[model samples]
Target: MSGLSREKLLGMYQKMVEIRLFEEKVFELYGQNMVPGTIHLYAGEEAVAVGVCSALRKDDYITSTHRGHGHCIAKGADLNRTMAEILGKKDGYCKGKGGSMHIADFNIGMLGATAVVGAGLPIAVGAGLSAKLRKTDQIAVCFFGEGASNQGTFHESLNMSSAWKLPVIFICENNLYAMGTRQSRIMNVENVADRGTGYGIPGVVADGNDVLSVFRVTDEAVGKARNGEGPSLIECKTYRRRGHSRADPAKYRPKQEVEDWLLRDPIKRFKEHLIQEGTLKEAELLATEKETALRIEDAVKFAMESPYPTPEEALEDVYG
Candidate 1:
């Protein structure tokens, strides 16, 4: 918060706002049956992804979850290509092959996102190994939900990452519920970050509602990784505004919880900060929203007009 320059800080705010709007657009299209498949939105938890990604270099890697749209956007993926992919068009990043969950641009060191639950863990550890063996200071980040943390792969991945001193960060977006099961029913520990100490690494919690808190904590962890300090586990306490997926209505979640988190919305907080700082004028914020709307409209047009990839291209990009 203190160290980040005004430009960088405002850029972070813009990215968060973009994610909120983009997810809203996706949800709208899904309701209208425009999107090809299901989507897991990041409407309420924008701060976690944006804050963590902001601390990373372009070369640093991040493995995403089913709710990966915000991650892609925060990491600087093109919205047009992303929207096209979700719409299953030829102009998509994966030529319409990969949809919302699997869309990725490895050129930006995203290393692809996984739709399978808890699958991105080992991949992240492997990326860390690759970086270590190559004598580079790069790090790989694995973003998963609380449900994933209970998986066997999660345990193995974290153990191996610590044992080998791999340059990786395990970020648990503990949104208080895994799909429909409440966190209290599943996780014994109130704080997931405390689990890191068991693996001989740093464990910390951040105010997932506050982007600044996320940015600061991740900056510390990432700086440590860059210095060969090995992997760390960070549990971001947040909530998902939308349901588990497009199909889920999130009836299991209590209304009180949702309302509580919504009161501390990341967008509102960032806007308040910007307003108080005098960097974000009322007109500027309104115009930004207008421009974002136009851009999303253009993305839809591009995707609709683009042709589906030919059958021959199906065999293409089959390998890693």
Candidate 2:
């Protein structure tokens, strides 16, 4: 936080708290049968999203994975609209069609989130290419899990972006599990960022739970991209506090592993850092949490009162 202003640091803290509370609320809503379909919570990986998005401009683009609520929130999506989208209400970002995993706000440069693994890579590459062709300094960020790193799209997108020097940042959130399948069982590589070397781009890894570490690395990448240095691959080693989806209990993981990651919880660690640094006091942190909780409650109320899309509305946004 040395180079960062007090306001920026506190903003990051607020965004992290917002994401944690929002995910927790989603968990509760899903359990109460108020939400439809499935959900992939972003409870533990708050730092990666906040860190990366905080480095971006409002006009910069971003693509997200199934576990993407954190990305949307970090990109400045309205909580009421985001909640409505998850609730499948008419007031949602995608007009209630995208649900939890597909929310998009083009005005904010949030390209969208997709449930398809590794799919967002190509889309982000496309956005980067568009920006390059338009001669804009805007960059696109791709947020995917380590599992998606093994996909052919990952290799192809990185290769093309590197060849053309497109402004895109490929972030691999290596949570170590691809829907309960451990990373050790899938890829042979020790780090996803290491793959960037093969694609002829800078590969860097950061402590995903440490907000400041993530922000600094991403800020550097953003500067390079804006300077036409092309795309960089950032592998954030993080953990998911919950299962792969709402239906998953994540029993596949060992108890010791879960406990270890919990101790490194990003939000808790950041709060402590802010307090210790005297950048924020305990009372201020408490007040922020209380305000965030109230905002989340307001969002929930809005989503609950919103109407669902009519049956005929399904075919409206459809195209051949």
State each candidate's clash count.
Answer: 0, 0
Clashing pairs in 2: none
Which 10-residue window of candidate 2 scores lowest in summed lDDT? Answer: 1-10
Which stretches of model 1 miss by more than 4 angstroms?
none
Q: Output candidate 2 Cα RMSD.
A: 0.7
Task: Please give the lDDT score for candidate 1.
Answer: 0.88
lDDT of each: 0.88, 0.95
Model 2, residue 69: C-alpha shift (Å) = 0.8
Off by over 4 Å in 2: none
User: What TM-score should be assigned to candidate 1?
Assistant: 0.96
- lDDT at 318 for candidate 2? 79
Residues 1-320 of candidate 1 have per-residue lDDT tens digits of: 36678778778877898898888888888988978878899998999989999999999999999889888889888988988899888899999989898888998888777789999999999999999999999999989998898899888998999999899999999998888889889888998888887788788999898898898899998988989888999989998887899899888877897888899998888788778877668778777777878887887778778887788888998986
Question: Deviation in angstroms for 66 in model 2?
Answer: 0.7
Q: Largest lDDT belongs to which candidate?
A: 2
